[model samples]
Target: MPEKVTVSVTDEAVGRIDEVVAALEHGGMHVDQVLRPIGLITGSIDTQRVQALGDVAGVAAVERQRTVQLPPPDSDVQ
Candidate 1:
């Protein structure tokens, strides 16, 4: 299954985010957003390819996106 992930670019690579995005795509990442100001790239990729994303140049870290579910406003679990 494809899992969403947030890729953090290294400080030194902030200016070259575009290149990093290209490399990530080449590595099987289906990019959704490129937050240039924060040097973060959000996207989804096969679980198997996550490790490869970490190896891409300029990538500081690769973290899986976590999902949180909430009950309705009137729910007892509130």
Candidate 2:
């Protein structure tokens, strides 16, 4: 079975992330290996309407996080 997902990104600046590495960029020197990226944001998403999101603009150089399923409270019992 395929996993169901609803992902979307808003073309807006929310905030910047901390940096942890130094690297050269085409434009100039940047904190290349940024632990996180700048201007990461989120908004409403509909997996069914993915086709309509082709024109959505995503932030630059930021990595998007994926949904993860955590074990139930009692799962620590194994």
Candidate 3:
């Protein structure tokens, strides 16, 4: 199944990140958020096709998004 992922771009490649985002969106991929200040992007894409993003000019890393579960406040675990 397709899943959410976070994409980070190299500092030197900042200008081209937007172009990559546009191309992904144009290809029917869902781009949920664009964090330009940190050069990051969050979105959902087909797991099988994730490697395609690596081929984009500026992408430094692609990571799968995972949710963290925190214990209730009263729990002993810290």
Candidate 4:
């Protein structure tokens, strides 16, 4: 299964996140969403592509997006 990840771009590459996304798209990766100001790109990438995505010039970090379960509303710990 492909994993969803949030990619952070380098300060110098902030405005060029699209270029990174374009490169990934050429490899059949999906570019779901992007935040230009923060240089964040969210996409669903195959395991094999994860490394390659990070290797893109503008990309600083690529971290897998994960879900965390929360306690029930009635739980004691606040």
TM-scores for all candidates?
0.89, 0.29, 0.74, 0.78
Model 3: colliding residue pairs: none
**Cα error, candidate 2, residue 75 (Å):** 2.9
Candidates 2 and 4 compared: the better one by TM-score is 4
lDDT of candidate 2 over 1-78, digit per residue (tens):
222222222324223222111111211222222223443222323334333333333323322236778789978756
lDDT of candidate 4 over 1-78, digit per residue (tens): 698888888999887777877876786568899888888888897877777777777878989888899999999978
Tell me which residue pairs clash in candidate 4: none
* Predicted structure with the largest TM-score when compared to the true one: 1
lDDT of 3 by residue, 1-78 (tens): 787888888888787778878877765458999998889988998888787877666779888888899999999997
> What lDDT score is found at residue 57 in candidate 1?
95
lDDT of 1: 0.97
What is the Cα-based TM-score of model 1?
0.89
Candidate 1 lDDT over 1-78, as tens digits, reads: 999999999999999999999999999999999999999999999998898999999999999999998888998983
lDDT of 3: 0.82
Q: Evaluate candidate 3 by giving its C-alpha RMSD to the native, one decimal.
A: 2.9
lDDT of the candidates, in the order given: 0.97, 0.31, 0.82, 0.82
On the 0 to 100 scale, the lDDT of residue 23 in model 3 is 73
Q: What overall lDDT, based on C-alpha atoms, would model 4 receive against the true structure?
A: 0.82
In model 1, which runs have C-alpha deviations exceeding 4 angstroms? 71-78
